[model samples]
Target: MNDTTRTVRLSVDCMGGDHGPSVTLPACRSFLDRHPDAELVLVGTEQALAPAAGWARCRMVIASEVVEMDDPVEVALRKKRDSSMRVAIQQVKPDGNGVTMADACVSAGNTGALMAVARYLLKTLDGIDRPAIASVMPNQHDGFTTMLDLGANVDCSAEHLLQFAVMGSALVSAVDGKEAPTVGLLNIGEEAIKGNETIKRAGELLRAVSAAGHINFHGNVEGNDIFKGTTDLVVCDGFVGNVALKTAEGLAGMITSFLKQEFTRTPLTKMVAMLAMPMLKRFSRRLDHRRFNGAALLGLRGLVFKSHGSADALAFENALNRAYDAARNRLLDRVHDRILATLQALPGAGTTAANEPPAARHAA
Candidate 1:
């Protein structure tokens, strides 16, 4: 039997994004309407969160400061201790009784600040080195391909890539309900020998873990393989993953812009576009980056998702949906189980579970 009545709570940084409460408030209201068993803890300044005061199943956590979009990670982490982003993440931290105020947290603030604050507040899970930003992209099969290390760690070693694969597998298994999803090492070619030494080494580790019945390693995949849906998940360093993500978004934008130009170029083109309106609309929606707005900061003790700062109501709502789904499905537990099961198989891993241990510098 399926359990549909489980209550899931979320702590949202209402003042984190570009539009602040204006966008988040509307999305929060819509999310509450869709999920009756869901609750929200909105964190922000009193003036910013005034509109949500009367919302049922919602509580406001007053934060004195709002971390600016350009605030340095150091400032956000040190100076603004009471920033909304920090406070929202704090909601997911377990209390003395091992109970958290909220099951998960969501923020559309500065990416670096979010990561720093989240790590400072929740810390990394045992057997996990560093947290990676994992999110989905639309694939050729009309499904999503999960990719990680978007921008969390600019430089990642082979061990970090393996850790990302483990965490990503757990995320997909928990949220997408795939027990053993395929994992792909993003490389220049399908062959394992194509990438640099780091990727090549990561491939060997992934294959070893797969042979042990841990993850379903799918060898190496090219840049185009991401959209080809060649595998269930793509593992790459933050630099490469972030570039791939931005390129995909740019391509989507180009397609939309091209369609609009064709529709308004001339009367005949307009008629042609009118006839193809339904198909074009479907294509547009399929490639909309806004539909996939939330990026999970994996390998953490608690759940924290990052949304695009420019996300509108629809996009922010989708981020909320992702966070809610992960929390309700117990993604944290799944990640812990996966890492613990495979920790010993991979050597020199999980040495950086502390906030910023010096030993992490020597991780493979």
Candidate 2:
């Protein structure tokens, strides 16, 4: 290994993804080829995982079942004991013979089940009301923005938002190399009185949370502010944020398609396209949400990441790198101290992590 790089063990769900192991195998192979020290653990039935195992060096974890697209979370966790997703999560138990979550576990499978499994296996940190899904997205200035709760929580409290603020701030710091990130509350308008009651309450809570001198709170920002590079971090409930994220992705795609048509309008334009294609490809990849698809189930006791179900191999590699970064940074330990301290100091902020980890219950 090089001086700047370290090895990271990653668990990949072989049965998930649009093309399953067919596309995933090549992506994993590409990643392993480039990253000599990286190791992969493939989870699925032997039949599904075997082909990939043949071409690349990987551990084949036997998973007798899989959660189909329409399967309910309850049924998958309860009835499907041998499911690929379940077996992968079980590895988090760390029985001394295998890798634990101190190494990260990632899935491009049923997101709900993955979240449930992580919640069950790794558990949440002390005083973290709900763990969030944080996505790193494009910034106009050749950088990225850290946005959270992209479908993790539907309804949020001021307390929950405040907690997200701290975690999200830490995330931007860790991934974006920003020592202190400016946080923006995603609202209808860039004003305090613009959002609904829940958001308003969350806003007030954010103000109080910011007063502690921890997060650099920038008050409110509209969805349009994301491209303006107005803030380093954007915070909101999963529903609105998820919609906004997907919309942005669709918009990016549409813009790219429009540019292609524009460039194809004439023979000279075609020459311009040929010359600019490489740069455009790089720019498009940089802006693709899936390029930054992995989101840590923040506030968890150990490493747990959720990637886009539609993620490809490049996206998988990105997720793996992200998980490695989170674990190396000791996110769990930091979150524990920050959350407990924040809660203890706040009004009605009163829960604590139990003696036993939440990994078991969330799994169920």
TM-score of each: 0.93, 0.85
Q: Candidate 2 residues 1-364, lDDT tens each?
A: 1123545566666776565676566666776787676677778888877777565546778888877756778877688878877777665555443336325566677777777766776566767879888887787886778888888898888778888988888777666667679999999898899989878988887777668766788999988788777999999888888899889888888998898899999999999999999998897777777677787778776667776777777787777678656644555545565566566556665745333332221111
lDDT of 1 at 351: 44
Mark the 10 consecutive residues where model 1 has the least summed lDDT.
355-364
What is candidate 1's lDDT per residue for 260-316, written digit by digit as tens? Answer: 997989999999989999998887788888988999999887899999999999999
In angstroms, give how far residue 149 of model 1 lies from its true place: 0.9
Q: Runs in model 1 with CA error above 4 Å?
A: 1-4, 347-364
Q: What lDDT score belongs to each candidate, Candidate 1 first? A: 0.88, 0.73
